[model samples]
Every structure is written in C-alpha cells, then in structure tokens.
Target: MRLGLIKLDHQQVSLAISKLDERAGEWALKCSTSVDLAFPTWESLKSQSLQAFSPPNQAYRVRSRFLSTRQGCLTCLRQSM
Candidate 1:
C-alpha cells in the first residue's frame, strides 16, 4: 500500500478480507502476495502522525461508550438500566 503500485482504500481492503473469510459465505476465496525478505521488520513499525486528530482520551471514551451500548455487556447494560 505504501508503494502505491496497487492502491486499495481501507474499507475496500477490509471488505475483501471479510469476503475471504470462510464464514462470510465465500469459502474458496484467498489472499496471496509475495513479500520480499527485504521488507521492514515488525519491530520497526511506526504509526502515522495524527497531530490534527482528536486526543486519545476522547477517542477511547467514544469507543468505550459505543461498545458498551452495542455489545450489551452485562455491566454496561446493567448500569444503563
């Protein structure tokens, strides 16, 4: 993706992977790619800068609220009721 030879949007890649799953009703599909041995190591991974993005605390709170609501967790649901 970083090389840009075969560009794919995030959602497109995710959907393709979901379809590749045997549980998603497409059993025969599979992903294949040849990664060069020269590719960067996992320990060298670094996140993209997001100075413009919202703070971590704000994002964590939002996700927590959403999971609490949608997943019907015992504690969260009990608290809400």
Candidate 2:
C-alpha cells in the first residue's frame, strides 16, 4: 500500500509518497515533489472555505485533524473538529 502527504502553503505545494512495509508496519518514502505556484492561484485556494473540501473517509478526516494540530494549523484544527 501507499500513502501520500501533501502540504500546501501560500507559496508552494509539496507532495510525498511512501510505501508501506507490511512486514514491519512501517512506511518508506518513495518519491517527493515540490513546486512553487502563482500567487493568484494560491490566493484563490487559500481564500476558499474549508467546508468546500470533504475527506474521502472518516479515518482520513480524523488523521487530518491530528496532523493539523501537530503542524500548528490551529484554525484548521478547530474547523476540522
């Protein structure tokens, strides 16, 4: 199995993929990419409400809130609850 991590900031987007080691129950990084985006595009996305996005699953939504708290995204953490 594979897991993806995406980080979006005002200036850029970063993506990382990790593959699961079933035997060890660990994840290893497989690939990553980072790209700077246009300010206008970022602004458009940043301005949108979180309500516009829905988690694909309840587990993902719970993890998303936990990660948001760890990352110091208090607003996002609060909104996710």
Q: Which candidate leads the pack in TM-score? A: 1
Relative to the true structure, candidate 1 has a C-alpha RMSD (angstroms) of 14.1
Q: How many residue pairs clash in all the candidates, one count each? A: 0, 0
Model 2: residues with Cα > 4 Å off, grouped in runs: 1-56, 70-81
**Model 2 per-residue lDDT tens digits across residues 1-81:** 112232344223221111224531121112212223322343443333132234448578787766666435456556668
Question: For residues 1-78, could you state the per-residue lDDT of candidate 1 as single tens digits?
Answer: 232343444433343334444432232122124111211322211121132234768778987886567444466556
User: Could you tell me how far off, in angstroms, the CA of residue 54 lies in candidate 2 after the best superposition?
Assistant: 14
In candidate 1, which residue ranges exceed 4 Å CA deviation?
Answer: 1-46, 70-81
Q: Alpha-carbon error at 78 in model 1, in Å?
A: 8.5
lDDT of candidate model 1 versus the reference: 0.38
The TM-scores, one per candidate, come to: 0.22, 0.18
Candidate number of the best lDDT:
1
How high is the lDDT of residue 79 in model 1? 67
